[model samples]
Target: MSDILVLYYSQGGAVRDMAQLIARGIDSVPDMRARLRTVPKVSANCEATEPEIPATGAPYVELKDLEECVGLALGSPTRFGNMAAPMKYFLDGTTSLWLKGALIGKPAAVFTSTGSQHGGNESTLLTMMLPLLHHGMLIVGLPYSEPALASTTSGGTPYGASHIGGASDDRPITEDERKLCIALGKRLAITAAKLVA
Candidate 1:
């Protein structure tokens, strides 16, 4: 079976929940599976170190995961209209993969969770694409063809799947947002399958 790496960094659990929904969508396809992984948190002190394994949730990501996956679904919570620091820290360490073209030609997608409706979910998704584009991966986005994109009042975008987590990051993923996450996952998995076949 081929694997689609679902890599994310979620502060309030919203992005992580979205990642799981996307993984379910990917696994719905024959011969495709999801490899869920998370990044370690960045240290503000600049000298502190996180434990090798997290207390809970997915394990920290490794560069080998990127090299081995047939496709990618990158998700993170939004921070000032950008990706969270942990995800960025992890991506910044992928120069070795970039040098070897490890992700080139693979299908990839992005997702994000924002604290508010106007809190930059789309921009975070778009900005996240910039590095993947540089890595030569093909970006797969949720098309308008996905009905949820047009009907979603909570969170769904042509750029990617998203969720509005509220200011306290307590809101649950809406039905529309959930569907779009699944759709995006299926889309990425299907595209990866075609390429592999």
Candidate 2:
């Protein structure tokens, strides 16, 4: 089975929940499985270190995860219309992967959770694609055919899956948002499998 990495950095649990939904969709496809992973926070004190294993959530991502995965579904919480700093910090460290073009032609998609409806969901997804593009990955996005894109009042978008987590990050993922996340994941997994075939 090929593993499609569901990689994310979620602050309020909303994005993490979205990742789980996406993983479910990926697993629904034959010959595909989801590998969930996360990144540790970047310390303000340069000398500070994170525990070898995170106390909660998925294990921290390692560089090898990139080479081992057939596809990627990346997620993060939106910060100022862009991905959180932790996710960006992690991506900045992947130069070795870029040097070898290890991710070339792999299928990839993005997702994010924002504090408000007008918050940077689309921009976050868009910005998140830059590094993937640099790696020569094929960008996967939700097409207009997905009914939720047209109907979702709270987060689904053509750019990728998204959720409005409210000002205090207390909002739950709406049914429409959940469905779109799954659809994106399924689409990504199926596409990856086809590419491999």
Candidate 3:
């Protein structure tokens, strides 16, 4: 079966929840499945370390995950209009894959969780796409055909999918936001399946 890597970094569980929803969408498609993964937290001190395996949630992602997947669903909690440090740190380590052109021609999509309505969700999505672009991956986005893009007051964007995670990071993903995340995943899966064929 073909698998799409649902890779994410979530602090307050918002992005993780979004990842799970996206995985569901991907798995709903024929001949596709989701491989959920997360990155370890980066340390302020270079000497600090995380365990090889996380205590809970998705296990830490390996570079092989990127090379093996048919598609990628990258998600992160927003940090000053960019992906969080852990996710960025993980992406920065992908030079080996980049040199090998391992991700080239694969389908990819981005998602994010932000603390407020205007909390840089779109910008974060755009920023997240840059590295994928450099890797020569085909970027997939939620088209206007997805009704949630028109109606969502909380979080949904053409750049990708987003969730208004709330100031305290306690809010649940809204219905429209959930639908858009699912749509984005399904779109990526369908496109990847077609491209592989």
lDDT for every model? 0.93, 0.94, 0.94
Candidate 3 residue runs with Cα over 4 Å from true position:
45-48
Off by over 4 Å in 1: 45-49
RMSD of each: 1.1, 1.1, 1.0
Instruction: Report the alpha-carbon TM-score of model 1 versus the true structure.
Output: 0.97
The ten-residue window of minimal lDDT in model 2 covers 41-50
Report the C-alpha lDDT of model 2 over 1-197, residue by residue, as the tens digit.
99999999987789899999999999999999999999877776432157879998899999999899999999999989999888899898899999999999999999999999899999999999999999999999999999999999999988899999999889889999999999999999999999999
TM-score, cand. 3 vs. native: 0.98
Candidate 3's displacement at residue 51, Å, is: 1.2
lDDT of 3: 0.94
List model 1 lDDT by residue over 38-89, tens digit each.
9877787432267998888888888999999999999999999999888888
Query: How well does model 2 score by local distance difference test?
Result: 0.94
Write down the TM-score of every candidate.
Answer: 0.97, 0.97, 0.98
